[model samples]
Target: MLLLTCPWCGPRDETEYHYGGQAHVAYPANPAELSDEEWAEYLFFRDNPKGPFAERWVHSTGCRRWFNVVRDTVTYEVLAVYGPHDPRPELAAGDPR
Candidate 1:
Protein backbone atom coordinates (compact mmCIF):
# COMPACT_ATOMS: atom_id res chain seq x y z
CA MET A 1 0.00 0.00 0.00
CA LEU A 2 1.18 3.50 -0.75
CA LEU A 3 2.09 5.56 2.27
CA LEU A 4 0.89 9.15 2.35
CA THR A 5 2.06 11.81 4.76
CA CYS A 6 -0.68 13.98 6.10
CA PRO A 7 0.77 17.29 7.16
CA TRP A 8 -1.53 17.49 10.13
CA CYS A 9 -1.90 13.81 10.99
CA GLY A 10 1.51 12.54 9.90
CA PRO A 11 2.04 9.54 7.62
CA ARG A 12 -0.76 7.06 7.26
CA ASP A 13 -1.95 4.18 5.14
CA GLU A 14 -3.27 5.15 1.72
CA THR A 15 -6.51 3.46 2.64
CA GLU A 16 -7.15 6.25 5.08
CA TYR A 17 -7.34 8.78 2.28
CA HIS A 18 -9.62 9.45 -0.64
CA TYR A 19 -8.44 10.72 -3.96
CA GLY A 20 -10.26 13.91 -4.94
CA GLY A 21 -9.26 14.27 -8.58
CA GLN A 22 -7.01 16.80 -10.29
CA ALA A 23 -6.21 19.87 -8.19
CA HIS A 24 -5.75 23.62 -8.59
CA VAL A 25 -8.10 24.09 -11.50
CA ALA A 26 -9.25 27.66 -11.90
CA TYR A 27 -12.55 28.72 -13.39
CA PRO A 28 -12.44 31.09 -16.31
CA ALA A 29 -11.99 34.66 -15.22
CA ASN A 30 -14.62 35.82 -17.72
CA PRO A 31 -17.00 32.98 -18.28
CA ALA A 32 -19.50 35.25 -20.04
CA GLU A 33 -17.08 35.87 -22.92
CA LEU A 34 -16.02 32.30 -23.45
CA SER A 35 -17.19 30.47 -26.54
CA ASP A 36 -19.28 27.35 -26.20
CA GLU A 37 -16.26 25.13 -26.77
CA GLU A 38 -14.18 27.03 -24.23
CA TRP A 39 -16.94 26.79 -21.66
CA ALA A 40 -17.31 23.10 -22.36
CA GLU A 41 -13.59 22.63 -22.03
CA TYR A 42 -13.62 24.23 -18.62
CA LEU A 43 -16.54 22.17 -17.45
CA PHE A 44 -15.68 18.81 -18.96
CA PHE A 45 -12.00 18.76 -19.72
CA ARG A 46 -8.95 18.14 -17.59
CA ASP A 47 -5.38 17.39 -18.56
CA ASN A 48 -4.41 13.73 -18.41
CA PRO A 49 -0.71 13.97 -17.94
CA LYS A 50 1.59 11.01 -18.34
CA GLY A 51 4.16 12.18 -15.82
CA PRO A 52 4.00 14.03 -12.56
CA PHE A 53 0.71 15.55 -11.45
CA ALA A 54 -0.94 17.42 -8.62
CA GLU A 55 -4.13 16.10 -7.07
CA ARG A 56 -6.49 16.78 -4.21
CA TRP A 57 -7.06 14.23 -1.49
CA VAL A 58 -9.13 13.95 1.64
CA HIS A 59 -8.10 12.17 4.81
CA SER A 60 -11.43 10.52 5.29
CA THR A 61 -10.29 8.08 7.99
CA GLY A 62 -8.03 10.54 9.69
CA CYS A 63 -8.17 14.30 9.90
CA ARG A 64 -10.97 14.57 7.33
CA ARG A 65 -9.14 17.56 5.89
CA TRP A 66 -8.35 18.15 2.26
CA PHE A 67 -4.81 18.57 1.01
CA ASN A 68 -2.77 18.65 -2.17
CA VAL A 69 -0.23 16.10 -3.27
CA VAL A 70 2.33 16.04 -6.02
CA ARG A 71 2.97 12.61 -7.42
CA ASP A 72 4.26 10.88 -10.48
CA THR A 73 1.54 9.61 -12.73
CA VAL A 74 3.32 6.48 -13.85
CA THR A 75 5.31 5.63 -10.74
CA TYR A 76 2.90 6.84 -8.07
CA GLU A 77 5.77 8.45 -6.26
CA VAL A 78 4.52 11.11 -3.92
CA LEU A 79 6.82 14.10 -4.00
CA ALA A 80 5.06 16.33 -1.54
CA VAL A 81 1.92 16.79 0.50
CA TYR A 82 0.75 20.21 1.55
CA GLY A 83 -2.35 21.86 2.87
CA PRO A 84 -4.70 24.01 0.79
CA HIS A 85 -3.44 27.16 2.46
CA ASP A 86 0.16 26.45 1.54
CA PRO A 87 1.71 27.62 -1.70
CA ARG A 88 2.07 25.10 -4.46
CA PRO A 89 5.23 23.02 -4.36
CA GLU A 90 7.88 22.90 -7.07
CA LEU A 91 6.31 20.35 -9.34
CA ALA A 92 7.90 18.05 -11.84
CA ALA A 93 8.30 19.42 -15.34
CA GLY A 94 5.00 20.29 -17.07
CA ASP A 95 2.95 19.99 -13.89
CA PRO A 96 0.49 22.90 -14.13
CA ARG A 97 -0.22 22.96 -10.41
Candidate 2:
Protein backbone atom coordinates (compact mmCIF):
# COMPACT_ATOMS: atom_id res chain seq x y z
CA MET A 1 0.00 0.00 0.00
CA LEU A 2 1.12 3.50 -0.79
CA LEU A 3 1.80 5.95 2.00
CA LEU A 4 1.19 9.68 1.64
CA THR A 5 1.95 12.49 4.04
CA CYS A 6 -0.54 15.27 4.41
CA PRO A 7 0.87 18.75 4.90
CA TRP A 8 -1.48 19.43 7.76
CA CYS A 9 -2.04 15.96 9.23
CA GLY A 10 1.28 14.19 8.79
CA PRO A 11 1.66 10.67 7.30
CA ARG A 12 -1.30 8.47 6.50
CA ASP A 13 -2.40 5.69 4.18
CA GLU A 14 -2.94 6.69 0.57
CA THR A 15 -6.52 5.51 0.77
CA GLU A 16 -7.36 8.50 2.91
CA TYR A 17 -6.48 10.97 0.19
CA HIS A 18 -7.93 11.87 -3.20
CA TYR A 19 -5.66 12.43 -6.19
CA GLY A 20 -6.03 15.96 -7.59
CA GLY A 21 -4.07 15.45 -10.79
CA GLN A 22 -1.08 17.51 -12.01
CA ALA A 23 -0.03 20.41 -9.82
CA HIS A 24 0.71 24.09 -10.69
CA VAL A 25 -1.90 24.22 -13.42
CA ALA A 26 -3.01 27.80 -13.72
CA TYR A 27 -6.37 28.83 -15.08
CA PRO A 28 -6.47 30.78 -18.31
CA ALA A 29 -6.01 34.50 -17.83
CA ASN A 30 -8.82 35.36 -20.22
CA PRO A 31 -11.39 32.60 -20.30
CA ALA A 32 -13.74 34.47 -22.63
CA GLU A 33 -11.00 35.08 -25.19
CA LEU A 34 -9.93 31.44 -25.33
CA SER A 35 -11.05 29.27 -28.23
CA ASP A 36 -12.68 25.90 -27.73
CA GLU A 37 -9.42 24.09 -28.35
CA GLU A 38 -7.54 26.26 -25.90
CA TRP A 39 -10.20 25.81 -23.28
CA ALA A 40 -10.12 22.07 -23.77
CA GLU A 41 -6.36 22.03 -23.49
CA TYR A 42 -6.45 23.98 -20.26
CA LEU A 43 -9.00 21.64 -18.76
CA PHE A 44 -7.63 18.27 -19.86
CA PHE A 45 -3.95 18.39 -20.76
CA ARG A 46 -1.40 17.39 -18.11
CA ASP A 47 2.19 16.19 -18.00
CA ASN A 48 2.70 12.44 -17.67
CA PRO A 49 6.35 12.23 -16.73
CA LYS A 50 8.14 8.94 -16.09
CA GLY A 51 10.02 9.97 -12.97
CA PRO A 52 9.38 12.37 -10.10
CA PHE A 53 6.36 14.59 -10.70
CA ALA A 54 4.57 17.30 -8.79
CA GLU A 55 0.93 16.46 -8.07
CA ARG A 56 -1.93 17.65 -5.97
CA TRP A 57 -3.77 15.60 -3.36
CA VAL A 58 -6.44 16.24 -0.79
CA HIS A 59 -6.48 14.62 2.62
CA SER A 60 -10.15 13.80 2.57
CA THR A 61 -10.28 11.59 5.66
CA GLY A 62 -7.94 13.68 7.74
CA CYS A 63 -7.66 17.46 7.56
CA ARG A 64 -9.54 17.73 4.26
CA ARG A 65 -6.86 20.10 3.08
CA TRP A 66 -5.21 20.22 -0.30
CA PHE A 67 -1.44 19.85 -0.73
CA ASN A 68 1.24 19.03 -3.27
CA VAL A 69 3.51 16.01 -3.44
CA VAL A 70 6.57 15.17 -5.45
CA ARG A 71 6.21 11.49 -6.23
CA ASP A 72 7.94 8.98 -8.43
CA THR A 73 5.40 7.64 -10.90
CA VAL A 74 7.20 4.38 -11.61
CA THR A 75 8.24 3.46 -8.06
CA TYR A 76 5.17 4.93 -6.32
CA GLU A 77 7.50 6.61 -3.88
CA VAL A 78 6.59 9.93 -2.37
CA LEU A 79 9.59 12.25 -2.16
CA ALA A 80 8.23 15.46 -0.70
CA VAL A 81 5.02 17.00 0.60
CA TYR A 82 4.13 20.65 0.87
CA GLY A 83 1.18 22.97 1.15
CA PRO A 84 -0.77 24.14 -1.89
CA HIS A 85 0.63 27.65 -1.72
CA ASP A 86 4.21 26.45 -1.32
CA PRO A 87 6.55 26.31 -4.28
CA ARG A 88 7.43 22.99 -5.84
CA PRO A 89 10.68 21.53 -4.56
CA GLU A 90 13.65 20.99 -6.85
CA LEU A 91 14.71 17.35 -6.60
CA ALA A 92 17.92 15.96 -8.03
CA ALA A 93 17.82 13.10 -10.51
CA GLY A 94 18.61 9.65 -8.99
CA ASP A 95 18.43 11.15 -5.50
CA PRO A 96 16.17 8.91 -3.43
CA ARG A 97 15.25 11.44 -0.80
- Candidate number of the best TM-score: 2
RMSD of each: 3.7, 2.1
Give the alpha carbon lDDT tens digit for every residue of 1-97 in model 2. 8889777788899899999999999988889999999999999999999878999999998999999999889898898998898899877677644
* Clashes in predicted model 2: 0
Q: Which stretches of candidate 2 lie over 4 Å from their true place?
A: 93-97
Candidate 1, superposed: residue stretches over 4 Å from native? 91-97
- Give lDDT tens digits, candidate 1, residues 1-97: 8899988899999999999888887879998999999989888888788877788899999989999998888888898898876777875476544
On the 0 to 100 scale, the lDDT of residue 81 in model 2 is 91
User: What TM-score does candidate 1 get on C-alpha atoms?
Assistant: 0.80
Q: CA lDDT of 18 in candidate 2?
A: 94
Candidate models: Cα lDDT each: 0.86, 0.89
The candidate that wins on lDDT is 2
